[model samples]
Target: MTYGHAHAEHYDLVFRSRGKDWPAESARIAALVRDRAPAAATLLDVGCGTGAHLVTFAKTFAAVAGVEPAEAMREIAADRIGAGQVHPGDMRAFDLGRTFDAVTCLGFAIAYMPDTAALDAAVARMAAHLSPGGVLVVEPWWGPEEFIDGYVGGHLVREDGLVISRVTHSVRRDGATHMRIHFVVADADGIRTFHEDETNTLFTDAQYRAAFERAGLAVTRVHDRDAHPGYLVGVKG
Candidate 1:
């Protein structure tokens, strides 16, 4: 709940530093939603950092809205999808007084919630915002069994004389993976180090199903793609 400006900006710099291969990933996620959603008119993009998914959803859906908590992240998302479309609120408590045909929390955003109680609370919030026969797609965090500790690496991207590098390390703890990212951006302004810490709960597929059920959403089935091992498509019933 404490991630703020610097953390959010560093997050954007870390994942999107490459600015390549994301289109394919975004396209794939959009296609999956189109296939599984009851209708793709209204979508609630929870934790829609920088509007990556919101932009994609807007291209297909008639109405698209995003809920982003971080101010820095919201600014980026607003620039992509327009300021009016993005709501500034926490994923656990944001309410729009309406329902959507589809709700998606991609990029393991749901895992940021500290515990099962927090996860359940957030899911209940999402469930309330979803219309009858709507669909909810969640890309959960990698389970503890899948985490690889002590992984240290960095990637650099160069575009138009601007360079960005993101270095990351991971530590696995009680059913969670805590990651620290170091971002270095080189431009005419020089180089700087921006640090951020993120924690994701490693909830199992069975636990995910149970949480959805407890939230009053019927878990139709889970579609797993080997390319994205931690992704799950749950059609609400």
Candidate 2:
């Protein structure tokens, strides 16, 4: 399940809540768009959680919309970019009945797909919504070749007399990486704890490119040596 309904509320608090530089990330995305789609105006971001990208892209794009599957995430995104701009939907089969100059499925959204077939369907859906000459940028999950199994990490954050902590352990199994995360929240309301499980398909670059090509999109995959996991760029012709 995505976000577990309750996980969404605590997600920002535990993960991006502590000094996360959203502006810098948005700026980086903007720069990428400037290079690939300097003239692109209308953009659609699938799985746009919390609206940081939408708000920043609004500075450059004339019309922007976001598609998020989780209601809680959509509510927060609506608050950030207005309710009209954030739609309730998923990447696999969401169609707004209109096209966009740029379509993106970022923030490891593609990783959530159960398998490469689902990933292909999601990419095709994103490609279907792109206008001619439109740009498509997808931030993928860790390729099986690069993923380190049995990895573990944790974080802690304190705010408004409330403390939130999270610990995650990842294990690779049968072409998928299973991430088990546990969260603890302490405040005047009392102490509470919960855990969430996320499974990401270990899709390779070749698989992603094949999907894009099947959708009739010219593909280019680029990986950052130190920064991002990598992005699969496609252009609709």
Candidate 3:
């Protein structure tokens, strides 16, 4: 979520090059919500980066809205889903003055929380935005046991008369993953590079469950074969 302007501008392009299927992922989320709340008509996506999922959610539900903190990313999302649909707000404390039938925090946005305290606040806030019998789905970052230290990855894509390359190296430090990402983009304007140092907390499964339970939600964990890490589904009764 703390992405730079350059990073935000090309986020979708880079992810698409890395084979992220937004449509399919959005479909699965919609299915999960409908399964729990058959009459689900509204949805609110927290940390909705660039409105990729919101675009699909708008088609699936009668009403869909999103909350994003990053200005650069939020601007792009607003353009895609209309300015009124995407709001500027933080995940831990955002009030839209209304409730929805389904609330989702996807794309491992929870990992951005610095600690369990923030995680608890964020979950509680999302749950508070849900109506009776509403469902809350949260995709989590890799658990402590799943993170591999000193991991390296790279991707290169050539399209639209531009050549883009991205590389990343990650290490576990102080119960979190510190990722050093570098991007090189070349076009008629010449080549330019951008660097990002991002940290994602490695919260345990128990911590996730405890947060959901503390929010007064009946919670369950699920693994989507196509998505890494997995998701925690909670129902507000």
Candidate 4:
């Protein structure tokens, strides 16, 4: 994963680069958890890149932990919260030897699983780490039929005497998003460019539910009137 070293340095700056209201969006996500698991006091964010979700979750939950596969991202997350609060492990298989009241797999992280079997493993692992009645919230990538092929996007950011620009070209193929992302960073040290290639699997709503059910969760797929991609909500039984 390119995020392990290079991209991790720029990961925290991305949402800001894209003009996303971090506080607002995190708050909305927190609200969603409160709605589904009103009594949830602990949370674990799988693929907790840069600890963005955990930062907000900390405000609402009594205890918070994050499982991030990328060492660099996990390191920053440790700095954000505490070293002991973050774990270095893959979402497909991780064990903290404890259960959480709520588990969050956001940022379409599940899309990186590559296939349905991998999704099953990840979902089952997450569900196994949930207390009875605990809730799992997953934000997934677009389904095969829903993806818009040849999609292009870009972002620019200026921070701490550095300027960064990123451009991405993506296309849907064979139930995956084949994406090429290029980044240019300029600072006092001069300028440099790097690229990362990613293939995020496009799993449909039914497929998502199937994984949750196989994990012994009661699942429901929800859609809103807004443009925001919806989520799958599952409750451990």
Candidate 5:
């Protein structure tokens, strides 16, 4: 399947399957960004899945907007945050013809870009939407080396007494990581199965820094938190 269609379908399943963890995680990431950003009046959230981070930031910032490529995800986000706030567009090509004090792309959204060229293009696109001295926060995917072979992680969700179990596995090879996720949901309607497959390049720290510099942004700091893999913040000169 094409990336767009696959992403849209995957996003629907993910949100339905993992809605519980989103709010707290998004809030924490927002706090981190707010600490580094100026008293900004506005913020833009790229890949703002389900408006989790975007809505949270809107509560504190003067204005908050989001760009999400998946229509299903955008619909869910708009329902929570209002229709005017979220736009359906790709992270690499969205243009609002305006700038913001802070730009954020969390949840390892950068990994979705395919290659260094696409990653660079996305960073440059984001940079163009940042005001002078603004901050661009990027959360990249973990390198393939970090994945443990033959290991698995899974979660069980019980909402309104309906249970769903989602299991994930990571397989690494050829300088890439392939993640396969399986979901089994049990409801009044009976059992249902959903499967998703995603791939991310095993990019190194140096490669990320190079991309940031090439986009004319200076890497100010790299933070590694125990809770999350962490992020790199770049400042527009």
Candidate 6:
């Protein structure tokens, strides 16, 4: 789903206020890439939202770019990076006509794929853009067993001159997590509310492994903590 204009406008502020560690996450990803390809110099971020990771990645990689499909989100990302650096594309079918030393699909963006076929297609396309011996890192959504049905979560943030409240409820339906998020924003201008509904596909670990293996990449799952589903690291060649 395309993020609304207001949601995109406040995306960074809300997440930052919520204490999402963008720099640390980018550092971890860069370290993961260097572990496999010591000389990795270029990187591509698929589904890069607001280019928060890109800001830090730019400091580590000599060249960095991003692919985002949502126009609202893409515009914000482009503004953060550069208009020439952020391209308009989707994960399942985007061809930049160049390969990078590292490719990343984070924030559980892979879960946006509706089915296994799409997942395979997405992985294959990402792998196709990897240079020989390059690394692909994907942070996946919760697996079927880990997802809690009818879960409710909320966050409130007051930053600068704005107050933002976000509430979310999720349910597992037909092997997918259906979530409805409501955001309330109040500023000097006025108070407004927005709703975002998203469905994330629930793929098993075996399914993710198969997608990576079928793409001709050696893959491993790295679960860093107990609360979150971990990353899938794949290497080309």
Q: Which candidate should be chosen as best, given lDDT against the real structure?
A: 3
Candidate 3, position 99, lDDT: 100
Which stretches of model 4 miss by more than 4 angstroms? 224-227
RMSD of each candidate relative to the true structure: 2.4, 1.7, 0.8, 1.6, 3.2, 1.1
Ordered list by lDDT, greatest first: 3, 6, 4, 2, 1, 5
Q: Tell me how far the alpha carbon of residue 172 in candidate 6 is from the true structure, in angstroms, after superposition.
A: 0.9
Candidate 4 lDDT score at position 7: 87
Q: Which segments of candidate 3 are over 4 A away from where they belong? A: none
Worst lDDT 10-window in candidate 4: 221-230
- What's the distance in Å from true for residue 49, model 2? 1.7
Poorly placed runs, candidate 5 (over 4 Å): 1-36
lDDT of each: 0.77, 0.84, 0.94, 0.86, 0.76, 0.93
lDDT of 1 at 184: 79
Candidate 2: C-alpha RMSD to true structure equals: 1.7
Candidate 2: residue 13 lDDT (0-100): 67
Looking at model 2, report the run of 10 residues with the lowest lDDT sum. Answer: 18-27
* lDDT of prediction 4: 0.86
TM-score of each: 0.88, 0.93, 0.98, 0.94, 0.86, 0.98
Better of 5 and 6 by TM-score: 6
The weakest ten consecutive residues by lDDT in model 5 span 1-10
Which digits, one per residue and each the tens of the lDDT, describe model 1 over residues 1-90?
Answer: 346675565555556664534466666666666776635678888998878777767877889999988788889889998899899988
Per-residue error for 209 in candidate 4, Å, reads 0.9
**How accurate locally is residue 67 in candidate 6, as Cα lDDT from 0 to 100?**
95
Summarize candidate 4's per-residue lDDT along 1-237 as a digit string, tens digits.
Answer: 548477888877876667655566567666677787889899999999889778888988999999999888889999999999999898888999999999989888999998899999999999999999998988888888878899999888888998999999998878899999999989999999999998999898888999999999999876744315777889887
TM-score of 2: 0.93
lDDT of 5 by residue, 1-237 (tens): 123333443454545475445556556656665676647678899988777777668777888889988777787788878888889887778899899998988878888777788888899999999998888988888865576765688877776857777698978766667788777778898987877777777777777888889989988546655434578788888
Model number with the top TM-score:
3
As for TM-score, the candidate ahead, 1 or 4, is 4
Sort order, TM-score high to low: 3, 6, 4, 2, 1, 5
